[model samples]
Target: MYNSIKEIVTAANETGKTIAELTIEQECQLSGKSRDEIWQRMTVNLQTMQAAVQRGESGRGVFSQTHLTGGEAVKIKNYRASHHPLSGDVMMAAVQGAIATNEVNAAMGVVCATPTAGSSGTLPGILFMLKERLSLTKKQMIDFLFTAGGVGLVIANHAGIAGATGGCQAEVGSASAMGAAAAVEAANGTPEQSAQAMSIAISNLLGLVCDPIAGLVEIPCVKRNAIGAGNALIAADMALAGCTSKIPTDECIMAMDKVGRGLPASLRETGIGGLAGTPTGQAIKARIFGNEV
Candidate 1:
């Protein structure tokens, strides 16, 4: 519904409405759904996210058929439980939570793609981790999803959120930005701060390529969501602390489009460059698909 970050932020400030409210209202107008209907839909999304996270951080964890990604989320949880993590509870919980969602996705389990299935872990991973710490109610968490949706809409309009189109910078990178903006509103930060957070988060992962080993989402894709979650949390805290991005959000979005367009096809989810080109990567692909390599 919003064309640019500038337009969304300025309007939110002037109208004295939260980004969540603005986005929900717009969705109502666009979809002809009542406010309650829209709210209910987002509630279902949040619930689905919760279910995936719960499954991931719990016993054994769901493993992918490829046998590449499984139980890593529980391992992280157990590690945090037994030892004092250098990253602390919030950060490690986010890491575990993010890996859980992607692990489930890789296993062909259900997951609500925040923007894309490959990048589903970032938002819920960060959101649920912060929920208890922030004492956010169910409604507030739902509002956070709406805020994330609003931020994502802006980025999607100006650029792309698909790895095939814009690489991981557009997928995980945009998801990180969306999480940062939504986290800002959840923490009671301003629209300007949300813009700053969004910019900071996206720029952190700028030029990140999609280089899945074995052409599967099991390798770096799952762990990348962990990184995205951390980036979003840091960006949100920085914005709340009055930190600013040297680049504006709208300009950053445009630059992302340009950078993604300039990247070679080998780096754009083709799995023929970066890590995928390594001997080990090739061997794994060969093992999976036969001696095609």
Candidate 2:
């Protein structure tokens, strides 16, 4: 039911329903559960996301033996508290949230796998930031999750949302797209604008590789989530300003699939390529794993 962006938007437009409403209706029909049940389930996910964000913000990111990435989020947080961050409050907040969530994941903390664990940081990062900035209620935040879920459903159905299957373009890219759509909806944008935001997000990060150093979801992964959050915010802003993507959302997803298929095996979640293959990356891996790379 409504696996394509076009279908989702059309249904939303025709029924005078938001994307979240359409998605909730679909979930109820498919699971034979009441709307309340679905809402309760998503609330659990929202709480989990919130907890991870809290842990991350408190600087609990260093979980690996190497201790490479845990303190960056905390550093950013500290810097923001004292200095005027060049990116402003909302962006700084998004960056901290994204880093904190990914830090939690890297440190083996609990996190909601929005589409997947590797890309979990984007949605919550943007949502929590916007929640405070826009004075959004808990119900409005849940609606944001549902709107994001709807975008992710279409992407997963059409292309794929895993790094091994479709590279980081699928992971962070899809998550950014989901975050963008959700941001638009949370700001009272039309479903069509949400679709446009999703497209802009996907297009912005196309062809990104999943080359985590040592095959660990640290290193560039956490920072990439930060960038993904930024992309989502800017894309949402663009959509709200009436900017439209030239390629349609569904077609953009198709292109993502084609690019994913064409990516070299070494680039697709294999630590043997990209950043993981660099001299510094290999040196870090050797240091961490005690292996001669």
Candidate 3:
């Protein structure tokens, strides 16, 4: 929503409030609800998602992940046995379940951006960890989401969010940037700090490839989320500590775009090269596609 860093910073400072507060205010205005009501609604939404996951239906939108606790996994599996439609959280849970079961996934529905389904667990997982560990209030969580949204919007606007078009940079890179910005906001970081966090995340993942094994979102995708989530937290910490990027957010985004564009088609989720082209990858593809590699 903000066109520039200055605009974002100015807006955050205008009310002498954090970006989360501003974002919640905006959401309240749009929804015509009081802050308390909005917070309650968010809580109910999360609870509903949990219930849906328990019922074997994916409740949340894209990129949702179930809690990683053992009890949570049991609940998710019970829900799946009931034939519930997969919500984003449930979908993510299924991916995690696959990882636990040491199997591969079929089709992966990417979250907000087109990161593989397996990697979708990272952002929500980090958000959940923050909320649970820090006991962040609803307002804080929404504000974090808003802050992350800013970063994601920038990536979507300047670079590209589709993995098919921009490879893993558009997917995992953008997710990491969003996660970093959100983490910084949750830590009560300044707008500049949040932007810096995003820059660090994007810079780190500048030229990541999208090489799903056998055209499946499994293989490297599931594990990548955990790595991305950790990187996002680290980036946020560094930025909050006053570390700055030599590249501006916009320039960093542009660089990501350029790098993504230069990636070979085989590395862009086409399943023609990268890991997807390996002998094991071919074997997996043959098994899944029922055709000769």
Q: Give residue 29's lDDT in candidate 1 (0 to 100).
A: 90
In every candidate, how many clashes are there?
0, 0, 7
Residue 100 in model 2: shift from native, Å?
A: 0.2
Considering lDDT, where higher is better, how would the candidates rank from best to worst?
A: 1, 2, 3
TM-score against truth, every candidate: 0.98, 0.97, 0.72
Candidate 3 on 1-293: residue-level lDDT in tens? 45555566678777676665665666677768898886676556444323322332223212312221123334444555676544444344433332222111212222332233444555665666677557888666666666665556657877987778888878778878888888887877877888899899999988888888766666666556645776787788899999999898888988989998999999998888887888987777777777853
Candidate 2 local accuracy as lDDT? 0.90
On lDDT, the candidate that comes out on top is 1
Write the residue-wise lDDT of candidate 1 on 1-293 in tens digits: 68898989999989999999999989999999899988888888988999999988777889998898889999998999899999888899888889999999999999998899999999999998889789899989999999999889989988999998899999999999999999999999999999999999989999999999888998789999999999999999999999999899999999999999999999999988888889999888998988764
For model 2, what is the error of residue 147's alpha carbon versus the real structure, in angstroms, after optimal superposition?
0.6
* Candidate maximizing TM-score: 1
Runs of candidate 2 with Cα error greater than 4 angstroms are 59-62
Query: What's the C-alpha lDDT at position 138 in model 2?
Result: 97
- C-alpha-based local distance difference test score of model 1: 0.92
List ranges where model 3 is wrong by over 4 Å.
21-119
